[model samples]
Target: MFDFVRKHTRLLQFVLVLLIFPSFVFFGIQGYSRFTGGEATAVAKVDGHDITRAEWDAAQRDQVERLRRQMPGLDPKFLDTPEMRLQVLDGLVRERTMLAAADKLHLVTTDDRLQRIFATDPQFAQLRNADGSVSKEFLAAQGMSSVQFAQRLRQELSMRQVLQGITATAVGPAGSSGTALDALLQQREIQLQRFEPKDYLAKVSPSDADIEAYYKNPVHAAEFEAPEQADIEYLVLDLEALKKDIKVPEEDLKKYYTENEARYSTPAERRASHILVKAEKSLPEAERAKAREKAEKLLAEVKKAPGSFAELARKNSDDPGSKERGGDLDFFGRGAMVKPFEDAAFGLKPGEISGVVESDFGFHIIQVTAARGGDKKSYEEVRAGIEDEIRKQLAQRKFSEVAVEFTNTVYEQSDSLKPAADKFKLELRTASAVKRAPQPGATGPLASTKFLDALFGNEAVRNKRNTEAVETGPNQMVSGRIVKHEPARQRALAEVKAQVRDRVAAEQAAALARKVGEARLAELSKAPETALPGATLTISRAQTRDLPREVVDATLRANADKLPAVEGVDLGAQGYAVVRLLKVLPRDPATGDMARLQQQYAQAWADAESQAYFASLKTRLGARTTEAAAAAASSPAAN
Candidate 1:
């Protein structure tokens, strides 16, 4: 074969092209694109730049992480929805559009402005130093250098500047704000006759024939079918298992302890009291001088009558937080206060008063009440913790090596997961009836979608072979095989008859209620003075009066220019609602605060203008979002 191919290299090459080119033309490009971060994955475009799938996925993960942090008790699955993911993409598009606009508008944040914002913004308090400087140490802790932090801050400033003009200056048209607020708060006296399905359920008796026919309906098959599932035996190669195998040398642990000795010691703290006078560095020199003189007088009083320091601080201190506590800054560790204040507090011994000291916040007179801590735990006392830490570090480093060996063993052995599990000392875990998607409350490797997907892959299912080691999470790899596969099957009608009967009954009941409600509505239309049979209450968007939201909306939306207007609302499965609007009343004054409403209206007006301006910017900059990248993005901003 080699001799023949060598002698006819050109001919062989031609034959190969003839055999492969068609496949390449049909499948190669598409198969390749799916893996690349180019056109195939672009969710949006801004200035002809593609926002790829990788970026969108990363943004969504970050968004989920942030939301998880903000609301720790909320289910992560709720936040990781298709709608929220698409919305995140929408946000990315809007962000990209703003960046493009800012670039075109030559909007660059000035260094001075950046410094001022970092120094004065309460949001950046954690990143601000004692002298109103950027905290390099804090930035380093966040893995951002000062230069990178400055760049990130500048980008944020620029993005803000793009929309700042419209949002900052927009004003609602005269009476527009009041008109909107009044409409929202407008109350209507309503007589609600709700035909709830539950109330009418007794009226519905679905025949067996009807139930059987409904169950047999093709549209309802999915709800009746048991999803395809499998029994799987999965082996996980993870840091936890590796840690059990790790043997840490005591000398190495001692070395780690010495290097991180600060971790073993309790940080020193000082209890102090101070009287501060408002004297920001940005204040005029004379004003600052006056503040210093005032602080000096307070210091003099403290020195003359040490016991009266707290009394003077309570009366004379401008620091609202501490002043209410008699200027007592309860025990705080180093780096908790400004450099000058900390120095003054720490320099004084117990019951000693310090001279006036200046800081970015103001001039302060300090009185140190007490000092404590600075205790160190011996090596033996913290030995176990240090050894565990060392083991984890070593295991982390060893994970990649073990994962590769584990991968090879799983694939080479192919038929079973036992070899890999035994080799890695991993538990041979078995899960029955595991579906492709993680079940609710699923945990560990079974909860990982990647592992489930690989387990259910065609090759793994058909051949009963182990899946390729899939990375389920950080330092976690899993390979699973199908022990038994169950294809999706329809349940017998007898099996789900009770549920089917109830569903059919509810649906029929709902339909009947709507029909009767509509008939009642027609009679009310003909006879405006017809008395309603159900509850009579005043309702508005602001106060629903315990009525169904549909009834409230129907009542509010009824043509109020003509009194005694009648409307019918179909409430789907809940049933129907008929609202008779007796009269349109003035917006209730007590239901909502007019001042707050006005402020909210003004804010909304500004937001709408900002969004409108952003849309215009998108048009000019050739920024566009793919339909798939947006779900509820078109919802009215103010509403």
Candidate 2:
């Protein structure tokens, strides 16, 4: 993998750039012990402390959100798989393991440090409210509470501190850069003999007897074992179809509108203008004082000549966003601006200038031009929307109750899905053939892994009975009984004789090709400058414009310490190539080249060390998880 990455360095770097930050930029730790209470099940245990299902679900949601935001055009379903879920679970388990060790070591994050991290990280920075407090509404939208967010942040920070020290040791020792630079910057040129498998195919032909002998080998039989599959007849209870019978009362709509009135009301807005003198939050006290003094002078000038405010703002204001429009910030509601700035603007009468105010961005001199909005929507205007929302809500609630009943009926009856189908008024559907996993273009409940697992399980397949109902979609449940079951068994040699013959021939040809290629390579390596009897192309360290990736990988990784060094690789269907290293070209390092190379090497070593550390940590904690835990985490519970 490293050799392939080195061969496609540019592409590798591009991929790495896209993937580097998402692993570390965590968000939404989900539920707190306070929020979940005793409702959450333990998904995994690290050093005896449990990492809850709620936490794992939260982490998976956070990761999915990150992927969606970063790659907007990507199909979200591609990210929804057992593999991706397992990756998220593993990450959560690793983090919990680290936190457990950190607790034993008495490592903790201070309030000040936690606040600083929140202020710095872009993910949490936007959640800061005007009053310099974290916004609960924003946190709630992210599926996190204040306590959960702080705990997650502290856990990450504590682990980061521990990892930082460990990874630092893996970086290069002092004065080692020069030697590394020489090897890294060295280039190589090679003479190559092209040997296509077609050339050997004509030279080596296997007889029918030889093919049969190879086909009958016990080692080859296991590879031909067929995967278990089943044909199932299933009943699907789709909520949307059931929803057609749901009804919403006028009184319910009115009650919903009255309770969620804030959703239909617009907050009051103020059109304000401000002249800002910018200073960094971390600026020295003296520097901050200077900016504030400048702001006061600007405020005094604005007070003296209010008519010239536009000219003064355009010339002196540090706010590039509004300075050109004469400090115009348009109209904004409460919570839009920093608390001090918002307070100063709202407190003033129209056409009145306020005293200098300080905010995180620095000091601001403000004036309110107009106040508008704050309209409460009438029932007549929102009646239709409220009715629709209430109807949908009621339908969803009814569906949940019915779904549970449907699942129970199917499980209890076990003989057939007819009872559940009759109870839910759903039609029994039959799938002709289904694989262990969903095939491309498969749709509906049949495509779901949970449903497939039940369909193929012992009771459903062997006993010819209905399996437990499986939730396949939002407000969707399904249960299936195998119509026909195919047990996993090795295919008969007669049935796959032609396929086996072709494979045996290919294997024999490749072996012969490799044997001949290795002998030629050995002979070529004895001479430093001898040419082989084939096409010779000049190759360079910077690029391999037309070479096959496998060839380039072999060339780059081949030792060039001794000229005419030989490397032979089997290129599958294309046969084998014997590469002869003819020259080793060393170039002088350009300005900062050595430093950059050293940094790259250091990063590689750090990553290796971190991976090793985490592996050891996982082993030490005796961490373990199950598919049952993942299923429990993903399944929705009654609110």
Candidate 3:
């Protein structure tokens, strides 16, 4: 079909004009305006330049791909969400802001500096060839060319200069962090006494009248109510179901195994050691010739006495990484070395020495020490794996073939799932008391939000019929019908009398705990040095002594001008706490921690200073995110 269109390109162009030109003429230019002005959907603006929806979408896709590569097992549905989109848009805006700052400041990295950094940076060592040329294969693998990589690196360097200026001048306030750290880590020797509601539970019991009174209160009505539930019947059509019906012949499996034989076989590896004589391509012609002549001498010596090759390599080899180990390159597959060196090494048989070979690095006398692998497994050894692979491939192919029919069947026969289930040879499963949201530990269709939403949709609930097939995951379709639905309602006092009584008792216990805690606080304040009944420990903002945050805050905020201070904390449902602040002490520093902490503090300060400067830059450059982004950023599902 494509070939026919390609051959009749002019005719197709004319036909396209006949079809689309009439619409434009009838609708005027308004129909095409949406495409021409794609920036109408801009999500953000940086330095007066609009970031079109297309650009934002492409960036989000790239970000999702990066995350998928990083965590292969992570569900893609979780990664490509509104929150993730907002994050990707923010990152794009930051980059654009940095670029704008770089342009405004005229901060451009020269080609010479780029080259110098690429040549000397250890982080890029793998991308550099022996003679300092960028590896074309590596760039190709990353889907970039030499020029594209250079442009990207140049832009990054220019952006780096924008923040580098601020960081270089940033320093934490001298002697202030120490004082602040002292206060933050200040230790208060105190006794922690907690009056827990659970301990007071056995001490209090509510009467029948008290239980009725508490149950009648409007504030506690929701406590006795149960969530709405539905009795549902669902059907799932996925790769597993398709695979069950797939049958592969023995001949087919064997054929597949033969076609992909290399995958079942280990790649051949060669372990070679070499005696390299320095003869770089950039060397003077006379010197390179001399180096080759010296390598030839070493080759002759190694071939004459093979046992002396290790000694020869140790003395003559200039490759320092392997010099101490007698030039042992270890086991390596093809393409692991430079073209010339790899060819010479692979062509030599085991225990054979190659003639003098000149490569980008130098002239080399190579020896093939040992070789292994390149052996394919027999049919029986890999039969089970091959059959599984064939079955999976067939199932995947079958899914696409049957997906449309499956969807149509569920929608056309909306009254029941039995028809579609029988047609697809899938089991129709049922569950009682299922909520609108997924229950804990739910799996398969039950856990899918899309399927759950479809199950409880208005049409499905009202008609008690099958829902339209929903694509819950990759190549997976799910459809559900509501059989019976239970509406949310409050329970009568008699049905929840015990629960109501428990709640009344808890309220009374909590009040009792609060009263006792307050009384103890007043008594301790009057007699500061009096003995307190609790565990003695040093507490601080950093060290809570197993106490609640509220208790820790109350203890630290208490008046400690005198020798001792008493404070009470209401811990909500957990009850109350009484603390006696005995004394204050400085934080104990770990050995050599002061210097490290100071350095960390300085770095944090530098980052804050840089961020503040960047914020000012954004203001100057007029950066803003659209209302669409602001609204979607707060979507509950985004986080």
Candidate 4:
């Protein structure tokens, strides 16, 4: 029943499945469905806490917005489906489950730590000036307050930390390293003797009666159904017709270049070095105070001897990433460092030492090594870029105007391509010898459901007229007038005689092979030793890769279970195979190979452990999720 549901569920499409869940209906009646003008629905209940419909909807909107931003031209209707809604709900449920488990374990982020993380974030820092101050205009433009954005960052970071801790605790150590993976990688050389089906082909031939009998079989008849089709003429309006109409005046181009000159300029940059003292909110106050004093001492030394800043940094800096290189950060433009750190670094002259600066990472003693000014690029260097932008903008505007006119002219003229072509002075193009199925030239636009429906629609074909203009791309539209239509008919039997004969012969050969195999099996059952003329059944431990390369994949899957003592099994297109399992290898843990396996399977083992841990946690917390939620989370429309 589940398999059948999976097959037919796809036919409902992404949008319908997301929006039409049974849970939604249930919540609607109870006045708990937020999306349908009621109180928030409870998608899941984790440890007595409700995962509300409002939260699920917000998550879904966030996922959709992210995808829309990444893929600018994607259809918005794709997200409004039932399937997508269900997928979003399912994901929210899982997240809620994880959060519940984290809470039980007392895993959480403090307010101070969250504040430090936000202050250090590069994206947030971009909203500040060179003097370490936030710009109100930039904050407004991004549609977020400092406090609101900080809270969001904290939630995301806390969830990440909790998930990492869970996974780490679940995956302990690699226990199957020595025997399992090592023995699998080792090669075993062997000789092969193949029983080719083509070798037996010359000995088998079917009579006329055999062919007729095979064709009469219900299974064989079912395989020979005719292809379904539709025939009609369609009118198309294409934007390519407006390409020649677009023009970029010299005055406009010059004006645009002059007005946006700063957009093409670059910013000044600086090089600096620093000594860092690592500190975290989780550390004791006493320990943190000690770390701060150490940073102050380093700052004092650097201030007294500015030229020796690099030497002091190399000796005292706790940041391993930059300490080895004398804490040199290399050249950076504006907004490259944390607010407090960047402000101190940029304010200093070359070879000048700064007072202790505090950031999320810890305290920093900065030294300005050098500075470089910005330069304007040559006009010739940026001319090609400017021209390309102008071309696209002008082309879109011109195409939109001309397309509307073309659509109007086609509708007002006689019901044929000739009249529309003459009225608009268009060179009429024809699709010669086109078919119903997808083909080159007309296939792309014609393959759409709406376009195909319009083609076979009464007004566009029987009455003959232009179609309403259809938008295919940004500022691009198309309209077409039908010129001709052809009806479909079946070909005579004589024309398809060769195809029928080949099909009949293929069926006969397969049946004959099966019969021979059955007869051999009957004899083997009576006397197992007499199954083969001289060959004896060999038993040995083997892996999937050790099997004959030329063996049919279907034969392996079908006969694998009937092993250790099987005889004369038909292998379909590969004749037959006999099998046996001699011995089983137990896993070994202590060896050099175990070290390699531990390194290689570390990620896979971690994922397996994580899944097991999640399942165990769900059971412990008595977590229950609706079918609708699971479906919503897995749907393609959710993202």
Candidate 5:
């Protein structure tokens, strides 16, 4: 049939069955195919349902193409991994399964509906001309023919119909009350106390003999090795060294404040009421028609007596939460509602009922109960907001001018902050001990890693001279002179005794716990069912999906497996635990609290059934697949 399709001039017949049928099936299969290899192979199977290699390859190629478009500079080597290929294949398989199921169920979208959907799609419209026709070149670039694209769209719409049938019954209107939503929003505040092994330092004094014994342990000795250190000096450029020369111009601040006035003004808001009729993707044509008729009738009644709009909304609105309150939506700013609804609501005079307004959420008949006009704030009221904007703009201009002059002055004369401060008659401030970070007030406008890098560099620190000034932010400059220098060094034994003692105690605690746990495990091994009398073992319930915090803490603090039967391992300050695998439980759909889970499982089962039907179709049709497709079919990861 495909060979005939290539040779014959009967384009319509070739397109309808050969091209259309194969493309549909190919799209479904290709989602699970790998694109990289010269040949395709299978990665997964549902029962005897085979996902072919060519299909998997095609899917992978499509994904790679998309990724390349998004991240042009991304490494091509990222696509080389078996894991990456498998992920692409899995996504393809899932989509294929759903589409196959939709076919089996005879779920379909009509040509009229598909055309309507495409016509309204913004992407397609964006590519169309004023005459309302798509450009052939653009269609080619997107890799789609009108027929092929429409078929794909129909398949998508059909799948959506099936999905809606499954999920719609479980998910009520957005305003419907449910405890599950309440539970999801609940926040828990906990007070916690942490216990460190260092707290028991005084009780865990080890003798000289103990220290020598500990040194014998390879794990303990490893901690004593000195870390590698580097000492080198480089030229530094500090930002604060240029601060003395910075001075703001009065005219610049006034100009900046004038250019950005609206930012300081507050916009108006209005309180409103509305009755929304939610639109559903799977809503039957007849039902939609009936809804439209009902909205029109309601509008007629409301228009005849506009004063009763709120009362009618209270009785008939599907939005249960606001219905009782006459559909009061409360005060909101612009961009709060669907564009059409917002435009209608905001355009209305106070106490006026709007005509039927169409939006993604069905039709709405809005009434503006009130309106508030926008207000311009007084200069004094917005003084703080204006001051912040002015300071930022002025500081930028001043810093740029000062930085250049300060840089030249330091290089020509003394390379010290004192001389620069004196020449400019600026106050000099000293910083407390700081590492690589800038000290408060000493940072000035030009604080940055670059400035810090220059300050700690060879010429500035080692040669005892001021480095060049550096730019940190826009209109900000900085340079620094080192007032004091302190080299890194290890503290003497006396100076660090407290810290060393705490470290020694933690080591002792770990060693003691390990020794006790090992002995307990040995005893348990001899008599597997024997319970150690008087030893309390705390057991707690935990879900596989989510482990409790206390359980996680206990597991991390000690090895529960090493604890003797009925003997607990101490988990520092948290508590002690002795665990044995009681049972391994698989996920139970029946036990799931979520309403969506039941629908999800039903859809999954239906998809599996659908894929099986398609596999049989492939066999009956004798679809001649390439060797690459056969290889992909053999791989477990291939969907």
Candidate 6:
């Protein structure tokens, strides 16, 4: 199919031009309206070229949508911060500058490459046709036409070319990476002594006055403040619930089965083996001919002695991926391989060999091995699945009509969800005390932020009415009202007196432990050959399997030029550890490996060079956000 398209390029181009003219006119009108509307406000400038507010909004939305898809249940409030908005705007500016650089470099992408990219992209894989052409339905679903998609693809490829050109020569300097690696891999020997909390508990006892003083302190009072919370009662209307009642008529099922038979059937697939004669696409004509001649000879041999195919492939096949496996490609469906290779293999019957076939990868001598699993399933075999699909469709159609009725029922009778629940036959569920975030043990539509926001808003909380029906998830609407609300206040000290006493005693005990440990270390430092009490272990600088962070850092930073250099680390409630640096040991010669660090070092340099190039490009482009736009980005109310 791709071969046919390429062969008729001239005729196809003429037809495309005729088909695209009206679309261009339609888009021209849209472009004019975009510039005339309120959306045309300029938010930034790149080399005196305006960046409209509409463009910024669209880019920001794209970033948000990408993040949402990558991370489900992500709190939208986290993305609404002023910092996030500015980061999004900066990203847009960077992209624009990159494209401008690409234009300056005159980088271009061919139509053939664009078609291949779109055909292979995973997002459109489901929409691909057997002929390798994407359908109109797919384009419409993506909200783009072929022309628009091609233009975007061209810009993306051009930007990639420019960036690759800029960073291609990024190489780390000599000896620098090795020195960094050596330092990172350095190991030092040290000795440690840990003082347990229980050992000092008996020595440190605080009175009631000490506990009272600690609890009354201003710093401790901040810890006890509570957050505002609410409880809501909600009614849900999920479209999936309607599927149980939807009955697809047998006649309608039969009609659908006939109209969309392909959806229920699998295309024929073939299993094949091939001996590839590898030759570079850009090889000299003589070299290519030599490879093709060799492949043709192999084809003749395979045709004469089919049983020797696997043995010959093992010894002569140039395809490393399958050479050892007798050049087997296993079973592959249509549109999986290059056209020429596929055409040659599929044309042969099982146990038949084909003449040498030429592809971009070079010549291939092929043999069809086996074929299986392309049979159309009987109607009875697929009845259950077809019934489910039909029911889902019916449920969706019913939802479209019922959603309106559900919204009206809730709005008109805002005082209670009883009416809406009864009309929709939904359950009126009550949720216990819930905060802005989802409440513990709470699941279903009521757990969503939108549901909580609507339920807790003044209209629902103050007026004590049902919220407007909110779409919490796909085909699911929830209308909720606050059943109870709690305003945040500082927790009373009397209610927490016991907890405060325990906390105060713990602090005093830790301080006592630290004091005792410090005194012991001081004494140990004075002695020529002193052994500290408590369990001691010799450890390496890079060894921190179970060592506390405070103890590890003190050991690493301690002066070990002299013997028995001591360091005291306060370990809070767990007490303190007195670590003694027993000896200064140089890094082990066997510790560092230069070979392992080269790729990482090279990648770091490449990243740095790319950043520097982009920084310079950004400066040269003279991209600047307007004061008003900057302010808007930093404001919570910014669109």
lDDT of each: 0.78, 0.72, 0.78, 0.57, 0.54, 0.72
Tens-place lDDT per residue, model 4, 471-512, is 655664545545666555444444544565666555555556
Give residue 287's lDDT in candidate 2 (0 to 100): 100
Q: Which predicted model would earn the best TM-score?
A: 3
Residue 578, model 6: Cα distance from true site in angstroms: 2.6
Q: Which stretches of candidate 2 lie over 4 Å from their true place?
A: 1-123, 138-159, 165-186, 203-205, 239-414, 417-428, 522-550, 557-566, 570-574, 586-597, 608-639
Model 3 Cα lDDT, one tens digit per residue, 1-639: 333334444543422222211111212111222222244566788767777665666666555654565455576767767777788778777877877788777888888998999888875665578988777765564455676666666666777899998898787776877766666676778887888888888888899988888988888878999889998898889988898888899989888988988899998889999988987889899999999889888888888899999998899899999888999999999889999989988898899988988898889888999998889899999998888778888899889878889989998999989989999999899999999888899988888877887888889888988888888878898888998998898888888887788889999899888888888888888997887886689877776756788987887777779877788899987888888888887785432477776777788889999999999988998888887676644443322
Clashing pairs in 6: none
Question: Global CA lDDT of candidate 2, please?
Answer: 0.72
Instruction: List the candidate 3 regions with Cα displacement exceeding 4 Å.
Output: 1-39, 126-146, 202-225, 238-404, 457-477, 487-497, 540-543, 557-559, 589-592, 631-639
Q: Estimate each model's TM-score.
A: 0.59, 0.55, 0.66, 0.51, 0.40, 0.60
Q: For model 1, state the Cα shift of residue 435 in Å.
A: 1.7
| Candidate numbers, best TM-score first, in rank order | 3, 6, 1, 2, 4, 5
Q: Per-residue lDDT of 173-219 in model 2, one digit per residue for the tens?
A: 54665555544455567777766655566666778888777767888
> Lowest summed lDDT over 10 consecutive residues: which window, candidate 2?
28-37
Deviation (Å) of 2 in candidate 4: 42
Model 1: which residue pairs collide?
none
Worst 10 residues of 1 by lDDT: 20-29
Provide the lDDT at 67 for model 6. Answer: 50
C-alpha positional error of residue 122 in candidate 5 after TM-score superposition, expressed in Å: 17
Error of 5 at 78 (Å): 22
Please give the distance, in angstroms, between residue 292's alpha carbon in candidate 6 and its true position after superposition.
45
lDDT of 1 by residue, 1-639 (tens): 233333444543422222211111212211222222465556677777777665666666665654554455565656777777767766776766766677667788788997888777766664467888766654443344566556656666777888898899988765898778766898888887888888889998999999999999999999899999998888878888898978888888889889999999999899998898989999999999989988888788888888888899999999999998989989999999988888878777888888888999888888888999889999999999998888888898898888889989999999988878887899998889999889999998888876777888889988999999998777888898998999899999989999999999999999999998889888898997888977668777888877777777778777778777889999999889888888788898776677877888889999988878888888887777666455423321111
Report the alpha-carbon TM-score of model 6 versus the true structure: 0.60
Worst 10 residues of 3 by lDDT: 20-29
